[model samples]
Target: MSLEQGIVFSVLGITLAMFVWNRLRFDVVAMLALLAVAVAGLVPTEELFAGFGHPAVITVAAVLVISQGLVNGGVVDNIARLLGRIGHRPTLQVLTLTSVVALCSGFINNVGALALLMPVAIWMSREAGRSPSLLLMPLAFGSLLGGTMTLIGTPPNIIIASYRESGTFGLFDFAPVGVAITLAGIAFITLAGWRLTPRREENSADSKLFSVGEYVTELRIPADSPHAGSTLHSLLTTSGDEPDVVVLALIRGEQRLAAPSTYKVLREGDVLLVEADTTSLQTFLDTTGLELAHQAIDDQEAESEGASNNDGLADESRGRNGFRETNGHNDAVGAGDDKAASDPIAKGELHLVEAVIAPESSLVGQTANRLQLRENHQINIVAVARLGHRLKRRLGDIRFNAGDILLVQGFEDSLGGALAELGCLPLAERGLRLGSPRNTALASGIFLASIAVIVTGLLSAPVALVAAAVAMVLVKLLSAAEAYKAIDWSVIVLLAAMIPVGQAMESTGGAGLIAAQMLVLGENLSVASVLVMILVGTTLLSNVVNNAAAAIVVAPIALSLAGELQIASDAVLMAVAVGASCAFMTPIGHQSNALVMEPGGYQFGDYWRLGLPLTVIVTVVAVPVIMLVWT
Candidate 1:
């Protein structure tokens, strides 16, 4: 081997090792590999960044934006709601949800389709009183199966299409092989796959799946509250009709009245700490006209803060400090005790989110009032649940403890930033988003037009999707800020950085060396064995590395193997496509799988119990279809 080939192979080895080790972030690892290759003289320094402009990267980014727009526009959410109405049995629900996710993935990005449907699955699980594990794995696996049905369904197919020397593979070329695999996969999952899922204990450290009723929270009595001037017994009687809604304490002027006497009179400006489910909270709020105590105070503080910034801060500083908070609290103001008297609950996008405090959380040991979370971040911790035990205390007085599940309510737009600031990991329960039929229809139309144009050859895939994303933004289907936030920047960076490194393998003859070695090892084996060998290698590699990176490395080897074996290259390439897209055995294999992991309350080992069988089904079915259709 040449010096360049040797160096490239060594870099590739270390890179693959790091990916499998799962230590560093994959994007960071990919960037390091790119830098290593350039420094090794395998790739020119000038061309290192060229991959950022590559069609594959552009198409992936555009697809992500369009997917997020569809989500924001409520296209997928509407479908999920309709599906929920139709399916009665758990098996039926799994079948319907998984099938729809797969079908959607055939035309759109698989990750996007999975992201949109995951909430629906979680909602169904919550309703059925089943662990999300029963549904999420199937939904994630289904998206992978569905992506195989079209050239644009996955990055590998697009990369494969771009590699074709003759006419590019038609949009529908993948349908025959992909449809067979998808059908077989969907059948196995619905009938047998989900049965293998282990049921996790609801209160286990590994599991956070529980009903909304389990959350303990505090709501304040506004001056207009009907319960004011009534006895504590009267307030509890009016609001605690539902057994799930329990009034635990009353807070008046830094004093906690726990289990107060029934004859105790409730007064204006008093805080009522209660434990209730989501339905009961809404009911109690509507019935008594009590606003979230912290939110009321925070809004007033934000207004004052906004006013001060407007008057004196420089433009850059204003932007920098706009949403900045220190230590999960506002350093500038107290709990805004005086401010709450004036600020009523202004109507806007308020979302109820359940977040688990991470071990390294900054909010630990600090009470909500001490942190001034409401004033600094506009977030109100309405409830706290520790180890399934409810904490009934004044929201301001209860200090946050690590692993405590907090149910916070805040504006829809600020929730992401606030979660980061507080070192909280959001529990996956697909909260409601504001999406209308008009926006949904517009997003659907833009998506269809992009696909139509691509199929008609009016424009290339990347250009068409880019145009669709831009149109979605222009039509206000998604705001400019929303569109930007929708794109997963880490994924984009990984793809851009890895593309040239993949090229280095081909340029330095490393890919050929590997392929030649593979051919020589399999010379005595039958062609069927050779095909399976290629498929198996690609599939295994995909589980450890990025699927696109796996495809880029294996595509050349598959084509080379076909040439040496005197077989149809199309069949071999089809094997590679199937192998690349079917990364079901590990969370790191595909983004769809990882997305469902936490929400489903899954451990790493949980994937293969269901995923292994599904993968076997894909292989057992894909091989014959590839040979029959292509050979």
Candidate 2:
């Protein structure tokens, strides 16, 4: 190999290692590789950052924005509502759910499709009396399958289309092969693939998937309590042996302060909403002399002469260890009281809901305390459930991860907006702003018109999609901020940085060297066998790194191999596209996979039970289809 080729290979090797290690984000690793190539003189300095403005990057961003617009316009919500009417037979439910999600995936961002529909799947599973595990993986996999059907469905497809020298692939260019594979894959999943999924139990109280019950309760401070006048910080830190409880909110008279300052002074008659287990609740009650709100109300009724006429706060039952029980619903404290009208909690405006962190959420790696969630968003995280693992840390001390299910408490009016800003997907269904017929019509019309433009060659894929995104904003389907926030910058950066690296591989003849070696290994093998090898190799690479990165790195080599074999370049490139989108073997493979992990309670090893066979099916089906059509 020449010096430049050696440098390119070494840089790529290290980049792949870093991607696999996953210690750093893939975007950071991609940027490092790009710089390495630039310093090695493989990529010109003037062209170093030009990938940021590439058509593929623009198309990916535009698609994400458009996906968000569809979401805001309630386009998917209408479809999600239809799933409730599907009969409860497991086979029928799986088929309907997967088919709908897959179809949606063809046009919208697959991850976005999964996020919007995941709660619906869990709801369907619960209603059908089945484990969520049975449906969630299939749903995630179906989204992946659906993405392979269209150019704008997934970032990998967009990246692959950008590799065509003639121009990007038309809107429905991938339909032939993609539709075949998606139908086959969905059929397999609905028939027998879902049976392979592990049946993990779900917390079924009040239709909630997580156990967020007595862990969060309200305690009232009595006038004689020794800790009544102490600051919250002082009370918690009084002794190292104090129970590991977090005060989520402080209620004084009609005022509710969520995530109150640690230094705020506690007053007699103040109610504290805290998160603690039974043992900690008892310990805190004993050591601090704080009484459960129900107990305190009973005591006040007993002491007053005419208390029988007052509202029956004493009627509220207490759970074990004197904690105020919410039964299954996380109803607010002081509910049903006219005196507390100023407080959202007392007015029944406060709602407790569960949300899952999205893979690209800004809240990942952040602590509730650090994000100032209660202060900034007027919301507090009462409890967290991660991959079926019980969290032992205090609520504020726990760091958030993608797929962590959080039980959040906030006013119903602002809760949805807060979760959206935080990049969380609510597990509970809520009213959609654009669920109205007019808005839905507008969003659908704009999207279809853009597809028409691309189909008729009126505009290129990126330009048409970008125009659609702008029209959506102009029509007020989604606001400017929401449109900007919808773009997954990590994927964008990874693509921008890796595009040039892929070019450098070809520019330095590194891709040629690798393709030559691949040819030698497959010299005795037929062209079909070589195609399978390329497809399978790309599939494996995608399982470890970002799918877009996998495509960018592999497309050049696939093209070179096709040239060497004197076969159609489109056929080889199509193989790479299919393989890159087939990252079903591991949760790390795709955002859709990881997004469902905790919700489904899937172990790392559980994915391959279905993913392995599905991947084999994709490889088996994709090769012949590509050969027959593209060749």
Candidate 3:
């Protein structure tokens, strides 16, 4: 290799290794690579942050906002929720969610599209008493397959479009082939790819949905408690080993205090109604000066209580006898009247959940009260987590941050639809996760119209996308605050950092070098083989690095190769775009895949079983389609 190639490859290799190790944030790692490359004189100092301003970067941000708007408006969630209830008949749910993901990814950033639905998928898997790992891989694969259809759907496509604009290709040139490949790929996934996804023989399904001991426990407050004289503080804190625990009620006298707060000081004989780990509860009680309130411990009691089928749901625990747990005794009375336990599926009832807020959420600065989240939307904000640290809950008072995780409780419907509307990302659960109902059609219309106008060449693509983003804010599909919250800065940072690297490659003829490598491989190969090789190479890169960054790095080569080979540049660029999105072999390949991993209890190797075949199928389907359409 030449000195420049060696230097560039050395940098790329180190950055990629760190990215896969995940010891450092991908954005931070990419930025470091940018700085190192510039300092080494392999990259221009002035152009280091160019990728940040690149159209692909901006479009990804805008599409995230649109996806949030769709979630806020309840357009996508409504359909996602419908699919959740159709039963755990694994095949049906997999196909349903995979199809939904594919279609959604066509318009929105696939990660954002997947994040909005991921929680719902996990919830549904649990509800149907199945291991979530079985379905998450399929959902991720569907998202990757679906991302191929449109220009803005995946980063590779956007990069391809930008390259095409440099006199390489025409608009709509790749759509026919993309559409064909997408259909055939979807079929392969639904029929065969899903079968390859292995399921662990989980004795209990709740293990996939609940953190197990993360919720079961005991809590005790000391005698002579300060709370004896104080009201539950207006501020609430939801941080604990028990993620599901929120102070629902406190008992001093027979009266119950529902939704007690940080301000509530301690008092003697006060029993705290909390969710906690059984072992941790004793230690916590000893540490806090509280004693365990004993329940009769015997086989008769256990047998009489009966076993529960709701995956350790607190509600099912109470249905055994007249005994029930409630935040406030009065609320329990209300629940008693409502009989929420009768049917766990359809009732508009209270539930506890965790969700992460997307980037730049409008709720960042506003107090939860300012949003009137509970009154206007009917969902309760139990707690908020900024970055990974749980914040002190003034709840109504805490400013929401992009990437903040939220602990919430409320009617499922309101939480599903309205949570997005309230400028929050509900942690993916597997039930029928719905979105806000207030503005579904309006948001969908504006988003689609932006594409229509762009396709008709009436407005520039950037302006059309920006208009859709702004209209979402104006129409209150998302508030100005919410619109900003929806944008992912990590992605933005990664793009900005990598753009200069791409420029450097083009400047040093690095792109030409890679293209030459591919051309050599395809010397006697047909057009289809050339396209497949390019697509496969891009796919492999995406599997190890950020999908967007992969696209930025490889795009110049797709263009360079097209020119050198005397082929239709658009067709070659489209091939690059498809490969960039097909990173199904690893969880680190896409944010959507990462987002689902912990929640679904998925192992790293589990994906390849399903994803490898899917990649092959896409290759088989796409190569010929490109030959037929682009040639």
Which predicted model would earn the best TM-score? 2
Clashing pairs in 1: 213-277
Error of 3 at 582 (Å): 0.3
Score candidate 2 by TM-score against the native: 0.92
For candidate 1, the lDDT comes to: 0.73
What is candidate 1's lDDT per residue for 1-631, written digit by digit as tens?
Answer: 9999989888888988998896667789899999999888888888999989988788878887888788778887677667668554878988998899999899777876876677677667766667777888899899999999987788888777766656667778999999999999999999888898767545432233333323445577778777889986576557545233545445677554443445678888887655565566677677767776566445565688763322211122321211123222211111233342222223334445666675335787888757767557767676777645556555556777655777776655677668855767565533545478888888899999998998999998888889999999999887888777666677788888888888898888777788789878988987778878888889999998888878877887787777777878888888888998999888779878766665566777888899888888888899988888888
- Name the candidate, 2 or 3, with the larger lDDT value: 2
Clashes of 3: 35
Off by over 4 Å in 3: 1-6, 41-46, 84-89, 123-128, 165-172, 202-208, 211-249, 254-263, 284-289, 293-350, 354-438, 517-521
Better model by TM-score, 1 or 2? 2
**Candidate 1 residue runs with Cα over 4 Å from true position:** 201-351, 355-377, 380-406, 411-434
In every candidate, how many clashes are there? 1, 0, 35
What digit string (tens of lDDT, one per residue) describes model 2 on residues 369-406? 68877658878777788878767777767888888988
Model 3 worst lDDT window (10 residues): 328-337
Taking all chains together, each candidate's TM-score versus the true structure is 0.72, 0.92, 0.76
